[model samples]
Target: MTEVKKQKPGNSVLGLFKEIFNWYPSSYPAAERKLLFKLDLSILIFACLCFFVKFLDQTNISNAYVSGLKEDFALNGNELNYFNVCYYVAYVIFQVPGMLLMSRPQLSRWLLPTLEVLWGICTFAQSRVTNVHQLYALRFLVGMLEAPVFAGTHFILGSWYSGPELFKRAGTWFICNPLGSMISGYLQSAAYTNLSGVGGMEGWRWLFIIDGIFTLPVALLGFIVFPGVPDSPKPFYFTSDDIALARARLARAKIRKPGPLNLDVFKRSLARWHIWIFVLCYICMIIGGYPTSYMNLWLKAEGFSVVQINQLPTVTYAINILASWLGTTLATIYPSWTIYTGATGGMVFSGICMIVWNIPKALKFVAWYVFGVSGCLSPILYSTVNTVVKGDSEERALIMGSMMTFGYSFNIWVPLLLFPTAGPNGAPRWRIGWPVAMTFHILLWAGFITSLLLHRRE
Candidate 1:
């Protein structure tokens, strides 16, 4: 898995263009070159910033629990895990339409930003929750608000960018996620140690309030900068030939097996070679990756004081950012093989961290740092959808849309539903992490191998 590999390709640009013609039906407009590039750059910047803030608000809960909420609510026996579950349930329910609508890339300019504001408010509302029920309601709504985020962003990026370009854009988005996580982790740590003085609010509540305030402005900015396909917008640079190409692209999109919530698409997605492989792979990567969300509580349970607990999550996330950058950079420079090596090493490192649960508490932290290497893979994979599947713009959009929706469903469910449970015994029971973490790696490596083989066969 660590080995770098190469893809078979025609040597010349013309051969590459011809290969694209065999599978790509989406035509381009002969727009003014300068305007086309300008609009795309503007949108990409806007979208990346929006994603960055959105993540900051979303991961606030993890911080809240570690800082104060768990003690105030006296949460016990997987309550935090339940918190993960609640949001995920709502997240799973709403992802499909968000993705499918991208079939008309035109819809995303409005759709993406609108959802941002709605979810931003939900994150703000979470600050006011006085009990578990209220937390549940607010978190659930936040999930619904956030449903379109990853899936929506995936479509938007793909609509404007080509296959090779997908990794960087997807990496751009994933980088936002960890950056969000890092920010949230640090904020959570800080709230616990210092910021509990805003109108008698607990540190957790203040965390939500602060996060909301941060997100609202960015959401507004999204409208001004969000990018989509060249034909989808007004005042775009397009020649008559380019317009014809764009039309052909849309026509091709229609035939790639798209429809409204149909069983066929669902079944096909489930049977997709990528699906089970990813599930097994991610289940472990995520399981190993669990520390990102749970690190605060773990720090406390492991004998760190509140101030120390603060440093734990923030530091671990810093390591993850480094890992994410390394992984993405590798893929960017060596598009053919960096990912598989990163994926295996990352998952296995995460497992080893957990497996050696008793060796020294410090090693778990190191393990998390290593796990960060693969932390960005899922989102990067979403960006790579175009490479794996061939369709006209419309059909390709549908496939990406559907896949992203389902992909988020996995994101929503796995953390909350599949995460192991323990007791209200007031101690972190991660001792059982050995088999659990090992199981995760076995499945994930299987996924990497499977995806590699499938990509090779294709």
Candidate 2:
């Protein structure tokens, strides 16, 4: 038998490689590892909690769609699409501005948790929507509130983790969506089975209620222990030395990707083809990604029972949770390559799966597998930016803002192309939409190829 090599402390590159390329697990003691896991766990739980609320919000609207939401609101195809479109508008309008404002170490302390509460309040209010207009108004407000959550989380990681650590921890944050997917799925399922008719509430109504109700307290808890940049004042736990270590560590990471400093900085950064390159890259991602958002609806239309539709997102999420970490492990070494490849490749596989969606019921499980495995690809986009950029607060902020603004800004219109008017169903028949969407994989793959060329020079 072959023996494994010993690892040294502080070998970020080697450790990352071992995680991705080797078979043996780390030899850290279970006791110490458990304790360390708890440390990361405590921090991760809050981060995951914050993510859970918003990610649930992300797909719950679609979950509502097949859960008798249309019947409740009497929504036309265009009106329902408008409800979906409004959130992206809020998301686009606020993303860069929020990142800019939150770049401050201190300002984020207030804004991050506060939005959670505010968004939670809005989520609770969504339970009251009686019209497509009301759904649009509420969803737009929810997206406006959530704009800060993702970018804010990435900026916060810059203060805390090193390059090697970013992907795994970013995995921790992104994994929550898969978990949230599972949660939303089961909750949607349970509501359909047990609660949709109880108290005269529909499953969609319960989705908003349960999500909002869970979010409020978690947001409050976030205010208590969530860490900020080393410069900020905390409640009582961190010593001055701890703060100094935090700054020193961050300073080291920043040296690797130092930000542009002059007026030319703005010109230089914007002039790069990468801005448009990644924008197109993510546009393809969202094209494939938009299908997952409608999974509950799609499954319902395919004649799966309501219970199955409600439960499907969670199973998909569980696969995603595992895949998200695995994707991180792959990216820690290849950072951009792993995700860019995965996103485009996942679209292809997922597309092929859709072509076979009419396969036997036993084979339908393959669809979710294809769906779940790609969960980690999206987070790597932000992780790639975090891995590469270096600078003082403003330049760093601009880098993140520019990447994400372009990345997400296009999503607002993407849904229109795939799910445009399809008679009374508001969703296209799977046979029609799936093929059109699959063809988009070719475009996304082209984006990935170009991105790889650009990244090789960097």
For candidate 1, write residues 1-458 as lDDT tens digits. Answer: 21222223367767544443232223433352433355446666667777787778667776677677888998766777677778877876776666666555457567777877887788878888878989888878888777777666766665555443455456655677778877777777677557677678887787787787877777777666664444556423344565455445435442132234455555666655655554455445556445445566667767787666766666656655655555544454455345655566666766665655576756777765565666566665554455454344444444554554454455654544444445532234455554555565566556656666776676
Number of backbone-clashing residue pairs for each candidate, in the order shown: 10, 5
Residue 251, candidate 1: C-alpha displacement in angstroms? 12
Best by lDDT: 2
- What TM-score, over all chains together, does every model reach? 0.79, 0.83
RMSD of each: 6.2, 5.3
**How high a TM-score does candidate 2 get?**
0.83
Residue 241 error, candidate 1, Å: 10
Clashing residue pairs in candidate 1 (N, C-alpha, C atoms within 3 angstroms): 26-249, 27-245, 29-242, 30-239, 30-242, 31-237, 253-394, 253-395, 281-444, 284-440
- Tens-digit lDDT string for candidate 2 (1-458): 00112223245866655566432235544443343353355456777899987888777776777778877776555665677678878887888789776766567667778889999999998888776777788889988998878777877776566454666778768888877767877778777777867777786788889999889888887788676555556645555655655566566555332333457656765776655666676666666666665666567667888777777656677878888877765665554554656655666776777676666755556664567776777676666555545444555566666655665665667666656645632553455567766776667667656655666566
